[model samples]
Target: MKKTYDVIIIGSGGAGMIAAITARKQGKKVLLLEKLPTLGAKLKATGGGKCNLTNTLSSEDFMKSFGKNGRFMSTAINMLNKDDLREFFLSIGVQTDTKDGFRIFPVTHNSSTIIKALEAELNRLEVEILCDTKVERLLFDGESITGVQTQNEKFNSSNVIVATGGLGFPMLGANGDGYEFAKELGHKVTDLYPAMLPIYVKETWVANCTADTIAKAIIRVDLKKAKKLKAVGDLIFTSKGLRGPVILDFSREITPLLEQYEQVPLLINMVKGKNEDEVLQHIKKQTALNPDANVVEIVSTLLPTSVSKELCLIVGAILDKKFKDQSGQVRNDLVKIIVNTPFTVTESIGFKKAMITRGGVTLKEIDPNTMQSKLIKGLYFCGEVMDLDGPCGGYNLQWSFSSGNLAGHLL
Candidate 1:
């Protein structure tokens, strides 16, 4: 006799767990498989151990934050919604609150608390959890997915949910196993690229200041044949280049150009106070304030010291003489320096360093409403496996939970 379930969910990340629990709540037998020794490895790493669970804003506000695929996700989000998620979390005993940006966090501010609450619920419901088990392939009969085959065993089921995450944080068991499973069912997958990844700037001083003092800097970018994009937030200084809240928030568009051009120029808008003309005026004032103040000192006033000195070197040729003796034209040129600081891009980090992959199972094959496959029966796809990706600040988790809830509760 073969063991069968009403639903078989692959992967034990946030989406997988949520799906399994939802199915169990619906009075369906559920089985969840995890490749790692324990569940929620990726969840544990989220929010730097705080677990930025969900946003409190309207579903429209939340959905729009997901980048291009935002509209496609609106369906699932509308069904499950953030308010429902909050209620679900509170019922499970993971009380929550939010910071200034309305980014929700576990009230306890500990990720493990949310994990434990979830684990307890799954325990009470008796959802079977298999750990240290790698699902190697998807098993199907004709066009319908029937079960899954592991390295040492197999499980059959009428319904199977592919919740395996994309190629981010592989050490936490986020390998692209779901992609292979989806392909086995004859679903075409889009080319996968890393989103919410860090950028590698050519200049060292920019990298350092981006890491330390001026960790948060707004960026204005002009890409090839694309509209100008601006990002305002904190960016970090990485050993390779830059990584932080802000840079990672908008990294998806950048890394690709870096690959194609090998030197994608970026404009960093450092001085926040004034427009370009006004900036030049400020520079003039700084020059007259102290003819003795070197270019370095004047720049350090407007920008962080480390980054200011670095920019001085890039435009050093313009003001060859001492600041005290420099001409008015040089002062104007100095003002131009703050308005535009361009750096060539080298290469974006690889998948192992990505926060979430940009592409996965193409959205067209699946009904975004039910999260069910239009090509095949008894097969469903959700989570980062879809061709959808979101920026940081709890958007990815929101997508994961909404999709999981819809897939689990749907007929």
Candidate 2:
């Protein structure tokens, strides 16, 4: 006799766990599989282990964050939104709160709190969890999903939800296995690209600014035949390259251009909301008021010492020369360096460092309302497995939980 479950969920990430819990709540037998030794391995590492669960953004603004692909998630999010997610977690005994009005976190501020709460709920509901169980492929009849094939055994289920994450943090078991399964079932898997990842640049000065942050830098990506893309937020300089909210948010657009071109140029406005004329005029006034101050000193008044010095080098301005002694051309050049700084992109640190992938199972094949595959009956996809990636600050997890919740309920 073969062991059969009412629902078989592949991968024990956020989406899979939620699906299992939901199905179990519906009085359906549920089996959750994880390739890694521990469940939610990658999820535990999110938000530096604080586990940013969801955002407080309005439904419309929240959906826009995922780009055009976000519209595909309308049904799922409408069914289980941020408010509903908060209520659900509270019901499971995980208290929640918010910082900065948008990012919501566990009241305990520890990711383990979330994992433990989910595990406890699954236990209470009698959901079966199989950690260290690698699901290699799906077992299906020609008409629908019949079960899943693991290394040791085949468990039967007409309802199978692939919540296996995309090819990010592979060491934590996010290996794009779900894409293969989708393709085998005749669903189109879109070209995958890394999003929310740092980019290696040709600017060597970025190393000197390592661990330093430009509080309000604006990043603009200029791609061939494509309109320039821009994002504004705090940007941190890393030893290897650039990393931070602004860069990560723009990474999805950068990845494809970097692949096609030898090097894509990234324009950075170090000072937000300041035009070239305004910045240059301000520098002139500052130089006149403090004639004895060196050019570097004058720049340091407006920018960090490290960044000011680097900008001086880029503009070929004399570091020790008094600001009053500098030519007007030098002042204009210095202002341009700060207002229109550019970095030549080499490549994005691939899937290993990516927070999420930009592409996966094409959205058209999955019903937005149910997260069920239109082609393969009873086969569903949710979370990063589908072609949806949102910006930083907890948008991605919202999609995972919402889509998983919708799928589970529909099943």
Query: lDDT values of the candidates?
Result: 0.80, 0.88
TM-scores for all candidates? Answer: 0.92, 0.97
**Tens-digit lDDT string for candidate 2 (82-184):** 9999999999999999968879999988989999999899989989989999999998888799999999999999899999999998888888889999999
lDDT of prediction 2: 0.88
Residue 154 alpha-carbon offset, candidate 1, angstroms: 2.0
For all candidates, the clash counts are 3, 0
**Best-matching candidate per lDDT:** 2
TM-score of 2: 0.97
Clashing pairs in 2: none
State the displacement of the C-alpha of residue 156, model 2, in Å, after optimal TM-score superposition: 0.9
Per-residue lDDT of candidate 1, residues 107-225 (tens digit):
88888987888888899999999998888887888878788888898899988999999988877887787898888778899888787877777776654464464434667665756
Clashing pairs in 1: 211-237, 216-234, 291-324
Candidate 1 segments exceeding 4 Å error = 207-216, 286-292, 317-324, 327-329
> Residue 249 deviation, candidate 1, in Å?
1.6
